[model samples]
Target: MSFNWINESTAINLALALVITLISYIVIRRLITAITGRIASWSSRSSHGWTHYLGEIIGRTSRLLILLMAIQMGLYVIDLSPAWESRVSHIWFLVLALQFGLWMDAAVLLWARSALSSKSGHQRSQLTMTMISLMVRTALWAVVLLSVLANLGVDITAFVASLGIGGIAVALAVQNVLSDLFASLSIGIDKPFEQGDFVVFGDIAGSIEYIGLKTTRIRSLSGEQVICSNTQLLQQTIHNYKRMSERRVLFQFDISYRTPTEKVAEVAPLVKQIITSLEKTRFDRAHLLALESNALKFEVVYYVLSSDYNQYMDIQQSINMALLKELEQRQIKFGMPVRSLEFLEDVPVIQRASSDVDESRMVQK
Candidate 1:
């Protein structure tokens, strides 16, 4: 009938602390939920407002952190051994560190999403946002982990030093991979080419199909996929044909030298007329560029207002056919390779003596 198992004061104090802790937890939990809910409601009212970030952070608050706070408050009222207090303190620190890390992770993700969403006409690159979010979360968790270790009386100096050495080793082992990863990041940020862009780099001409972390996949003109390292791609010169607003075309042709000079001069004007008559074309100039041993060369320069290769080819084919027809009507001929050979009318001939005559002459001598 006598509760003598424990000290009366200690028992009473412990019971009171437990009751206070429970009451505090319920009250704090309800308060947090109410406040966060109200903020969320307010944010929802203003769809495009800065209060969304605040509401998000508040909503992400960890229930474990609230419980930890209640426990700490209750424990503060009880008497405990130094060892027990130390252990509890370390546990609290660990929880706090983990909770902070979670908050940071959430914040980073939300910020990334918001930034990407805000991009209207020019959307931010998804790959870049993903990389940024990953790095931020990783760094945050790393710091939190180190802080927890240090709080638990772990010697972080050696651990950090070892980590640095390990990092260096890892870097050296995967330097090329790291280089490509960074290059991919650069590509995302610099926007040298985007997905579905026609690009020529080195000897490869293709349309970018996928831009990845280590390599970019391209659909080659020859109907094959080309996988190129991002580092190598960045190192080479890239010709992004998709960015070209107009294409300049230079073409040359030859006419027979026997063509009348007056008619030969008409070649340039005829070409200009034909080119200017075509839609989406701007004729720059046409001239007799050179008189070679084989033919008279005419150089023509024009611009195609379209960047489409097929459109350019079609325009060029039409112009060529029209010019050919016109030349035929004018009795003009295209130059052809010709060669001539000359022969002497008369020539002296030398013949070798017979073997029998040579043998007889040698016998007589």
Candidate 2:
């Protein structure tokens, strides 16, 4: 058998082209890496979002893509068959499509992050931002996938129609879940309450731990988790204590009925003084509200300037203690539950006639 080797001219050309491609790849890759690093550093220092996003894209672009480009150019130096050339072109198209998709996905993420960060406290909700990011990424990838399919000469019309029908079926199957999901989105937008906010919805009072698509988990006051569907939660009246600017407190206490009318009258002014003496308290009104069967009821109304429950409790306690001390010093008494019983002086007693007759008979015998 006779063996034929490649021609010297072709062999030399291939070797030279390969060596130059390798050297160019190393040099170009390093240059790109260095430039991207510098750009990233500079963009990081700047507050402009677009610049930073551009830098991030540049930094994240795969070096292999650059190498592939170099190799494609190098292949031109060697004469290749039409079939091989067509294969290389397809390869380039695929790589470029994938790289473009990645870049677009990254851009969406970066923009979402920036938008979330720039929002005000009332406008920014973590779940909302996450959902927005997810939707944007999904849409971007869908477009990319369609482009890739088109590039590969795949007819996607029927595929897209089938996807729509499948999506409708899936949505119908998960309608309840979808309802809750939309409710969660509404909560994010309307902001009835956010994570970490203390809220009372229905009979459950708790701090929101997490807001998810279908369910919102709350850490209840009794140290248990309360998981409620977002749809159900939205249906209830939510008392968001976190948003309260001040707490208006109306409390009543009773003094003994034995207290003199003048002293009872003095009680209101005394309570008002006690409440007004405390910081962050606004005394609204104190009055001898009613005369009950057992005691005279006094009503006190005040506002705590702070939303902090602990702070309000502390102020209320201080006022209560001071009021108690004042009443004690003035020889006043607090009302207590009392009961009364009456007794008759005299009552008739009846003896059994059978016992009397038996005694008489026994005596006679």
Candidate 3:
């Protein structure tokens, strides 16, 4: 029997294409699974766990691409109108482009992790890697979007002009956010502080808990979390205390003025020896600075051979207690200001004689 375009040929072709599309999907999914499994096996052998991550991203990307292509081919085979077919194709292409960008971004992260493993001492900040990957993906997506627009025969010149005009207002509305984002970028590049570093800016001092796109989270000494804008953090002078291998401890005390100068000199050396003998404390310098209005001033400056704040305070307390006990044992008294007036018998007699002489002079007159 002879067949015409109007009757049955279209339905038969569509059914065949549908079956082929389903078969393609199943085969492609199996291929993706097999490829991912092999990659996981290689990762176990190669000692680079990051490769496993890369494989998973690629596997999913491959499955998506295959599904998209199968759908497009099936639609074309079903004898749809030209306009509808074109629209579907364009949509599929856009989706494919977006997925491709995502896949590329994932690959970038996996590569960065591998690079970090090869090098020793100070890995690249994860925030930095994330920002770079995002920027790269954004640029790629921008290109892909523009390409799709061009394929659809959009007027590129007019679109560029409109974007330029609208961009100014959008920038003004979000300038603060943009500033913070750029500042975050600068921080990632400059690396003034990283996660787990103790930082002090103005009166806000804390250990960095997280570095985000526009803010950084810090855990304060009081155990409160503080979220600060990156723009402000970059603007201030940051004190990174975590980088220091030692901490400096300085303080002053007073001794009695009547204490012998020789004894005062001996006190410094004794204190020095005591501090140096302690664990994780260094004897830097101690001196009898001056005799004050009420008491003699003594200054002690030393280094705690550790960055631990608690240990530093503990060492300082021990030194202070030892010094106080030593002074008491030496019978050196602490100075105190006293105000008093004493009248002696000789002073009274002199005053009486002066009064008598004045009275005799008045009588003679």
Best by TM-score: 1
Q: What TM value does model 3 have?
A: 0.65
- Those runs of model 2 whose alpha carbons end farther than 4 Å from true positions after fitting are 1-20, 41-54, 78-89, 108-132, 182-191, 210-213, 222-224, 252-269, 285-300, 308-311, 317-365
Estimate the lDDT of model 3: 0.82
Could you estimate the TM-score for every candidate? 0.79, 0.69, 0.65
RMSD for each of the candidates:
5.0, 7.7, 6.6
Q: Model 3, which residues run further than 4 Å from truth?
A: 1-3, 6-31, 62-64, 67-99, 105-138, 184-230, 240-245, 254-262, 290-297, 306-311, 334-365
Q: What is the descending TM-score order?
A: 1, 2, 3
Estimate candidate 3's RMSD in Å. 6.6
The segments of candidate 1 whose C-alpha lies over 4 angstroms from its true place after superposition are 1-3, 6-8, 45-50, 79-92, 114-128, 338-365
**Model 1 steric clash total:** 0
Tell how far residue 215 is off in model 3, in angstroms: 6.5
Q: Please, what are the lDDT tens digits per residue for candidate 1 over residues 1-365? A: 97778798898889988988898899988997898888878888887676778777767878878788788778888888999999888878877788778777888998888877774514457898899799888889889988998898889999999999999999999999999999989998888998889999888999999999999999999999999999989989899999999999999999998899999988999999999999999999999999999889999999999899999999999999999999999999999997989875543321233556778899999
- Regarding TM-score, does 2 or 3 come out ahead? 2
